[model samples]
Target chain A: MIWLPLVGLAIGFQIYWLPGLSLPSSVAAYLSLATLAGLDSIFGGIRAGIEGKFHDDIFFSGFVVNTLLAAALAYLGDQIGVDLFLAAVVALGGRIFLNLSLIRRYLLTETRLRWRREG
Target chain B: MSTIASPPSRGKGWVFQVTALCIVLGMLLALSLRTQRRAVSEGIPNRWPALRAEFINLKQQNASLQKDLAEYKERYEELLRKQATGQAATLGLESVLQEAKMLAGQIAVHGPGIIVTLHDSPKRDVNETRPEVIENYIVHDYDIRAVVNELFAAGAEAISVNGQRLIATSSIRCVGPVILVNSVQVAAPYVIKAIGKPDVLQKALELPGGAADGLFLLDMIEVKQQPDITVPAYSGSMRFYWAKPLPQPKEKSR
Candidate 1:
């Protein structure tokens, strides 16, 4: 069941990779920032699911809004001569790390408790 | 410990949504990574500043090289101009030298003029064969000099007597029976080749009271208007022991 998302991720990567889709270099910075935001949201969702606070509406809306908002903010910053792309990367990277740590802690705690009871 | 634990079953639907979103994320990540890799390989992102600096350096080098090329082209044209003027001056000097050579009679000349032949008269006294009387019938050095003076006054540019070309230092005189022209001995039937207008030279010698009139009466002179006559170059060496050229007057030195 856990491997289902990983398989889906592989499937999506192949969908773009097999077709050899290309984007302009000018948009690369924003796309990378958006990807970072999406990763952060995924980790946050996983952590919420572990804590029993997962909401389908929030997860779906967050993913869409965060991806679009990150790319748009970076583009706007570029037009206005600001380094908002770096800011977005730093902010989203921090969240991803935090969410990843929390998920790790939750999974480790669950596994240990289950093992102790069984033993 | 139980408070931090996962519930037995919250919502299984979140996993499906998360999977779907992960797929989207995977696609975005693939596209971004591909684009970034391409930008890096193209050397547009990280190496932009260094490449720009090298480009500016190359542009400056090209500008300086172009300036040097322009200067060299200007110098080449200037040298060509100087060479042209120098050649012109050389040509002018060459022509002046040619004219001076002609005037000095140091070069051979040929043109239309008359040839006067002065020999001992063919007529002889049949009744009295006296040597002095025969001498009166023969041509003299004065007769030859008179004929030459007449030719010169008639605009003869060049003249030669018996192959001896006459120059400004030339003299026609007799040493006994031999006549010396330019100090070179010449014999009778003196064929005087004069380069000038043939008709004018002939007419001047044939005038009733001309310098050669007496020789003409005795049949010692024969003036023929030839279409072509050749005057040889002077063969004698000329040198001045005490003559020197005078400097130009200051007022006339324009």
Candidate 2:
């Protein structure tokens, strides 16, 4: 899961060659928000997996719903003259940070225990 | 913590799904950032009917917000009038805010000033068969920027080009054949309106070797001083993501 973004980065290089695949500038906001939502779902799934609660169905549905909801919120904001995407951004951003912190703590504690037992 | 139960190994298929989704998400994020950068450097193309709809919606929302703001201000003023000390303090703060808004180009300004209109010379192609010298006959982004810089130097309080108000972050650049002011494409003839002293602005422009004279010599730019004009406030996001105020130092406890 940690290496997932790096893999995405490697694949992102193809975007330069496939210029026609690029989205219109107008939808950039929605797309970016959707990506944020997707990233949040991914991290949540990873956390769930680590906590012995990973479920395939939950991960799949959560990913799709989160993305769509985020995009929809941005579209609604554009229509209503408010930046609803900011809410999604802040929420998803906070979750990502929280999840990362937990993941870091878990990994650190696991490594320390394993090291003590081995020694 | 180390002895905690881990989830059952998800099959390769689940791994594949998550990996694929992650890749897609990464690509989308990268593409969005790239598009944002392009839009910043070379103004986004004014395409899509949806954008026009969004513009209409935004205009209506702006009107409603303005109404709400006025109502809120009136309520606040009424409350302030009830407290003499708070009223004075608030009055001072209000004036400071107004001045700050003016300086930030966030407030609409109206005053006597000059209007400089720059257009490509009509007789350029008619007389000169040489295509290389045609560049001198047309207005460029730098020309507009120079004119703006000169106007500011003359103490112009506010300025707008093609109704796009100039702010601190306003960028003027040439994209292809069109000139972009504040990332909005502006077509010729570019009518630049500046709010300041009418005579001083006019004089500053017409000064020898100034923006007006240099442009006129090259492209026959027109500078006009009008007695009354209005420059609208900036209508864009003022968010500064990278900058933050430093935390105040706390007094050391004895």
* Candidate 1 residue-wise lDDT at B222: 82
For candidate 2, the docking band is incorrect
Q: Chain A TM-score per model, please list them.
A: 0.96, 0.85
Q: Which segments of candidate 2 are over 4 A away from where they belong?
A: A1-119, B1-82, B127-129, B247-254
How many steric clashes does model 2 contain? 0
lDDT of model 1, residue A49: 79
Question: What is the per-residue lDDT of model 1 for residues B1-254, given as tens digits with 9 covering 90 to 100?
Answer: 24333333476667787899989988988898888887677766622233456776888999999999999999999999999999998998899898998899999988898888988776756676888888878878888888888889999999999999889989999888788888888888899999998888888998998898878788888878888778889888979889887895677631
The lDDT of each candidate is 0.84, 0.79
**Per-residue lDDT over A1-119 for candidate 1, one digit per residue giving the tens place of the 0 to 100 score:** 76778988998898887787869776777788888899988988888878888877777788989999998987787667676778888899899999989988988998999999999
| Per-model TM-score of chain B | 0.74, 0.62
Interface RMSD against the true structure, candidate 2 = 5.2
- Output DockQ, candidate 1: 0.27
Model 2: DockQ score: 0.12
